[model samples]
Structure formats: structure tokens, C-alpha cells
Target: MDTILDALQEGRLFELLDNDKTDALQFLAHIIEAFPEVPAGTDVVGHVMKREEAMNTALGKGWACPHARVPFDEDLKCVIGWSPEGIDYGAPDGKPVVLVVMYLVPENQRNHYLREISFLARALENYPGLDKLRKVEDLDDIRNYLLDLIDVSKEPSGPDTRARMIRLQARTAPETLVFQDLSNLIVEPVTLVAGQNTEPVVLTQNHALFEWLDSVKDLIGRIETEGVYQNGGWRVVRRGAVNYQGSRIVYDCVAFKLIQNRPEKYK
Candidate 1:
């Protein structure tokens, strides 16, 4: 439940643009690949598609869970894609699948992942608002139903965060939404994910990007504040603001990828 709730809270949930099962899974895999936890060359889509060919993952009642497993040990991550129109997933129940939850499983969290899926199955079967989920038009509503199924404990979220989530739910599918305005970068938190001699990918948030940004913090070795940037041989490649509901969450995005043969610290 935490993994699923974590995905929802971080804006990992999307209104799926593709209704075909392969396209939908591929779309979710594309998002997963960008995650810093995923090794640079992991073929998430290929792995998931191969698994799907072995068995249909649809849980009926318009829900499907597609996942890829890897050998690395890292935090479990997932992204949820909602298709109100439902995808023609080959479910045993003969129902079109509308909710596709894709998980990235690693060696360390295998047992934990199984338990979570078990709970999810139980909760969804008895969830009172299952029917409502099928008909909802707003992504926010879809998120709410999924959270409710998990019965997540309430946490006090800021207004900006709430507004951003609402905005993300309302938008047409874009690979990502980033605003560039450096004024706020002086005060906001930004992160960078990259490799040696490779172009870095900028990821950031200020409480409005659904909390997913936190997962990458582990991949960062350390950030030493110097003037406006976190230094230690790292430099800002991008400065941008995520604007939502009149609030701007700015970031000074630095970058990294698992450094080779470093200290046992990373191990």
C-alpha cells in the first residue's frame, strides 16, 4: 500500500493516452525508465511485455497490474495509469481493464512486493467505490478512489501541493511539465541525475510534484551548499519552476548516476 500510495502522491498516476495493452504498458515503462533507481540500461518495457506474454495481469473489474523485475536492490517503485474508457486487456473476467498499475520490483523487496499486491487485491475487491472509478472523468477523482482503497492515513499537505496535483490531473498527457524561471531557484530544492561524461536529467519539486522527487534523493551522494548551488564537483544544468495554481516551486537541478567502484557506502 505504501508503494502504491507513494506513486499516487508523487503524480506517478496518469490519465493513459493509449488504450492498447502494449501501448499502455510501454507508456508506463517509459516513465519508469527515467527513475534514478533504475539502472541506466534496464529494458523496463521489454521485461514487462515479456512477462505479460506469459500471463494476462488484469485483475478484472477494470484493473490490471503489469510489472518488471530486476536484480538490483532498491526501493520499490510504481506508476499508475488510468484509462476511463478502459483498455482491451485480455482479462479472464472478460472485462476491459481501466486501471493499469505497473511496478518495478527489485531483488531486496520481492517478499514485500508480494504482500503489498495481496493487500491491494483484497482492498480493491471490497472497495465500495469501484464502480465510481470506472466512470470518473477527472484524474483527481481517480486518484482519490485509489487512495481511499488503500485507506491512507491523512497527512497535512500544503495548498501548493494540492493545487499542483489538481493541475496535473487536469492536463493532457505530456511527458513532463516543467516551468523555467530562475528567480525562485535560490530558495527551492532541485536534484540532478546523470552519469560520468553523460548529459544529466533534471528532476525537481517543491512539495507540488506529488512527492515522487524524494525517491531520487537516495541516489544523490551529498549536496554541499555553496552560494546558490549544491557543489562537490556538481553544477546546475537546468533551473526551472513547476508552476501550479499561482505558486512556483523552483529547483537548481544538479545530476548523477551510480558512480563506478565507489566506496562501500553505496553498496
Candidate 2:
């Protein structure tokens, strides 16, 4: 999972002028230059441009993920650019684009490119920060947050997937507990399909948040099954450091409470 920071750790992602469309193209060029992992010359840019022509990568809500695949001797690389003020990207919303994530993949590695696309799109689907990015001043913070989001989502079978599956389970009711077992967990309740469905679905911000929540769930499961209920001699232990700022359980608990109190829409 290539994070926003993973793409920008060495100052790889750039923040360019909203009006500088050419710079966006140049930004792609720079990624090729910086990472020899990508193929050289017009081929790289042409691949990117060709993809752009196929469908404006400007995914709405001020975020665009532009990507291309070409023959490469190396693995893969990503280039990212941000336009916090938003750029006049030819998008359906015409709201301008604030984030641009570029991907360069090897021609033989079709699966890798698909995985990258899926990972990023899933993160942005319920992203709670389209409004927040408008005000954030620190680029590192944004980069790190994005990185964490990607890292947590890629896990196949683990507590992270379990926690996400729990949230997925909660979709059955008009209101449900988006609970997690961890302490000081960051949870953001996303009211996705707010009006489209009669039932309220609890959407999480990203997989990292889910991973934290999943860990908590595991701990809780251990307590219920192994310690509190089954074993005769048991002691509660603080097994892991709690990051209250981004813990999923703590954040989702808040969301659950709010949903419980709020009026439910019949339509």
C-alpha cells in the first residue's frame, strides 16, 4: 500500500498552482525522473495522458487519481500531487480538484495496478475530510493520514478485516453500534447513502481506523471467551498503546451514540 507519504516521503508529491495544468503533466515527468523504477521518456507521459483521455481521472469531491501502466524492468512507483485550493480539472462536478494521486505500473503487472486503484478508491469512498483538507495547513499531516488509511486496508484476513466486516454487518439496521473494543480509538461515523437507502449504513473513514477497531474487538473477544467467562484466574492487562486520536472504537462509539439519538428517515 503506497501511502500519500509513501509517495511523498522524499518530497515526491507536489503542491502545485491550481492554474498550472502543465505543471500537472510535469509532475508526472518528475516522478519518472525521481524514480528510475518507472520507464523513461514520452512513453510514461503518453501512458498517463492516454489514460486521462479515456476518462478524466478527476474523481469527484475534489480528488483525482490519475494512473497508467507500461512495460517496465522494475516493480512499480507512484506520484502524487495536491491542490488544496482545488484546480479547474475537467470533472463532472466542476468543483476543481484538490488531490491528485498518480500511479505508474509495469505492463506485466496488471494486478498490481488494479490493486492500487481499488485501494485508493475505497479509501476515498467514505473519506470524511474533503472539507477538512480545505483548511489544513500542514502537508505532512495530510500525507501521514493518507498513508495510514492505505496501510490498514490491504490486510486480507486479520482483525482489521474483521472489524470492517463488523461495520459491514451493521448495515442491516437503520441504526447500529459501530463499536470497537479498543481504548482511545479514533472513530469517525460516516453516514453514507444518507438518503438513498431507508436503512442507515455506518461507513468508516479507512482501513487503518478499522484495523485499530479490529484489535479492540480481538481483545474484547479474548476477555469474554478466555478470561472473564472461561478462566478461573485472570487479570486485565493493557496490552497495547492506545492512540486515542485515531482509534476506531472510540470514534465509532461517538457515531453510534449520535445515530441512536437522531431521528431516522423513513424514506
lDDT of each: 0.62, 0.48
TM-scores of the models, in the given order? Answer: 0.59, 0.51
- lDDT (10s digit) by residue, model 1, range 191-219: 55444444334455434321433443533
Q: List the residue pairs that clash in candidate 2.
A: 184-244, 185-247, 186-246, 186-247, 187-251
TM-score of candidate 1 versus the correct structure, residues matched by position: 0.59
Worst 10 residues of 2 by lDDT: 250-259
Off by over 4 Å in 2: 3-5, 39-42, 151-267
What TM-score does prediction 2 earn? 0.51
Indicate which candidate wins on lDDT.
Answer: 1
